[model samples]
Target: MTTRSSPLPARLKSLLLLSCFLGGIGLMHAENWPRFRGPSGQGLSTEKRLPLHWSATSNVVWKVAIPGEGWSSPIVWGKRVFVTTVTDQSTRCRVLCLDRDSGELIWDRTVFEIVPLRKESKNSYATPTPVTDGKRVYAVFGDGSMAALDFKGGVVWTNREISFYSRHGLGASPVLHDGLLIMPFDGSNRVLKAGIWPNTSDEERLGWQIPWDKAFIVAVDARTGRRIWTASRGKSRIAHVTPNIHGTGRKAELISPAGDVIQGFDLRTGERLWTAYSQGEGVTPSFAMGEGLVFTASGFEKTTIRTLRLGGRGDVTSTHVAWEQRRGVPSQPSLLYLAPHLHSVTDGGVAHCYQAASGEVIYAERVGGNYSASPVAGAGHIYFLSENGETVVIRQGAEFSVVARNAIQEKTQASMAVSNGRLFIRTAGNLYCIGSKH
Candidate 1:
């Protein structure tokens, strides 16, 4: 006869199990600002009441000087904030960890000094933003060197996989999923001029064909820097843009913007899931994902915006695409959707509103100045920061209405990060945190 122990109260057992599950889910969302546009790479913050207006002298909690020259945005986990900056020489790569509340520099580490690398005039060595998993922060340099640092500023591992030429440098920020750090390498080895009579030799016309420069995404273990898997993109230049993970009923798909195509890969196995061809190159913008559809705006000769449904196999180019919008799409900044409508500003500063579900144009208005930073949305308002130090705050709706056109004294090319009911903008000269006191 087996003597079984009496079970605890049924209600108490169920309550304890539910509490543990909820706690795990909460912790999962805590350490995740993971990519170019925050969680999910959507540029939408569920963080409520993020401050709208900020200036150098007003609503500033703290301001700290970031050394070096990098346009990458900041990522935060718990009380620690992480940002990458270039050293004074522009040849050394630096990563700084800051206290989120006090804006104090906790630890500063210079990781690499690039000796030989080719980058476009507009790009820099530290343009790629760092990604963190709460325990480790991963920084990728333009020379194809990626290093993972512990929370206490200790180096875990570093890997220099491939070396190639970047026409505009390394602007593609890394993204994290589970235990993997995903990075994209897209480079072209040739530069062509239109005229000069078309009689130039194939070598003169095309330059050195960099057969090694192919578009591919690699996923490495965040803890050990080991390559978990890599998916090749076959002779393409995919730069600047980051990847977004979308749900496809069965599993999550890692969606990325390769040159002239928006491709999806298996998040678990690094398998090619699907591809949607578009009329774009140098794809730098992140996608807005929701309601079973992913919206992407192409860059640099990207005249159209496309919406593709998630979860398709092979070449779902024809069957998965929902709709495409062709007017005033952005070439640099990423797109933002306020649920029912999509909002974006072109490089020349044309603010556009489109129906998110149907891809219909609602309104088009000029906002002025040139823009490269991804716009931030908060407090029912959309914020557009131009390259000329102009901040345009607009009401989020079908009608294109400007709420406030504010300006700063300095130039800003980096996107603003919102946290703890405050807005942090990193400009060319300084970093400003804006918010009102309680």
Candidate 2:
């Protein structure tokens, strides 16, 4: 009789160790907004006691003018806060680092100037939020210039290899996984006119002399800013969604939205793992991970939301789909999954709660305004920011219940950041730090 021995492959064992390594360290900088949707990319802040109410004139700890125009949210690390902005002529790109407590501008560095300007009315030049790893801060502009600066605002390294179209501007934020800083290049290859974005492909889909909108993700060394890997995302148009890291039993993959597909790539080498064919095009929604599923939403054309399961080899569309939801998914705003319940506000202001596991609607009610910014979850409450400058707090559960409604005097389309037990909200005019500070 022959005896058989069973063992795991060396590659599989290595992947297991990688997963363990990522899990051991904390994802978010507890007192920092390192990426788009806060730490862990779920929009939930582990803050102990965030303020429940605040206004333009009351409960405001400090207010600071943001300089030029860019709707990017603020990210803070240690004592420094960072945000990106562009000049009024849309030529010069800059990043400002401020003192976290005093709101003092520590360093304002001009990154670059656009040679030939390109911009859409709806998109600004510096819409992508910067990412920091406590040591250095990274920012990318609409012109495809990526730069890194030390905590003291000294230039570390800059890359001007890629050239991106300036239309609808670059809104995708950068993220850090392991020691690599990842950024997305998603936009039209050529200049897009105002009336060309709608239902016509003749004038809208013309190829550019340089294919900047090839739909790809690039990873760079966090410390040195060297190009580590570049993964192509096929031929897709513009996407304003930021990428997030997802955990599997095997390894953590960078989950990103490209056109009508949600893809997963190897975190270290940018190897394409898998891509799920999302039914909708022009995907602007980011991924939310929880309950063993990755939720993705689309913006234009066929609007729908799909929940995908993690860990699969090639196109795992059939094997990994957990559930799908079609009602009230936001085009621009990201969704929040709070175990057993998923909450999101549609572009039309319909606040919804769905059973995350089953994709069944628990409640869909109107909250009364448009929402472009993603909500922040903290202290057992969900804070929804509307375009009309209203912050509506609701209890997080299956049933819908409003906790409080706080309205700022100014209109804001930017998201809120919670760090170091304080809520930092970026409005159209100023950055307000809301907390007791006592």
Residues 125-244 of candidate 2: C-alpha lDDT, one tens digit per residue: 777888887888889887778999888778899998876663455778889888888998777655435423435554355322122336688898888888999998765556778999
Error of 2 at 85 (Å): 1.1
| Candidate 1 residue-wise lDDT, 1-438, digit = tens | 999999999999999999999987754443335556776576776765656566667778888888878888887777787888878678788889888778899999888777535566667787888887778899998777899999889888988765545555677888888778998776554342332222445422121222233567889988899999988875554456777777644487788876677788888888887877777666777778767788887766646788988777777788999999888778779888788888888889999888889888889999999998999886788989899777889888887788877777677788877766666677886677667753
* Candidates' C-alpha lDDT: 0.76, 0.79
Q: In terms of TM-score, which candidate is strongest?
A: 2
**Cα error of candidate 2 at position 137, Å:** 0.3
Q: In model 2, which runs have C-alpha deviations exceeding 4 angstroms? A: 1-30, 191-203, 206-213, 248-250
Give candidate 1's error at residue 389 in angstroms: 2.5
**Superposition TM-score, candidate 1 onto the true structure:** 0.86
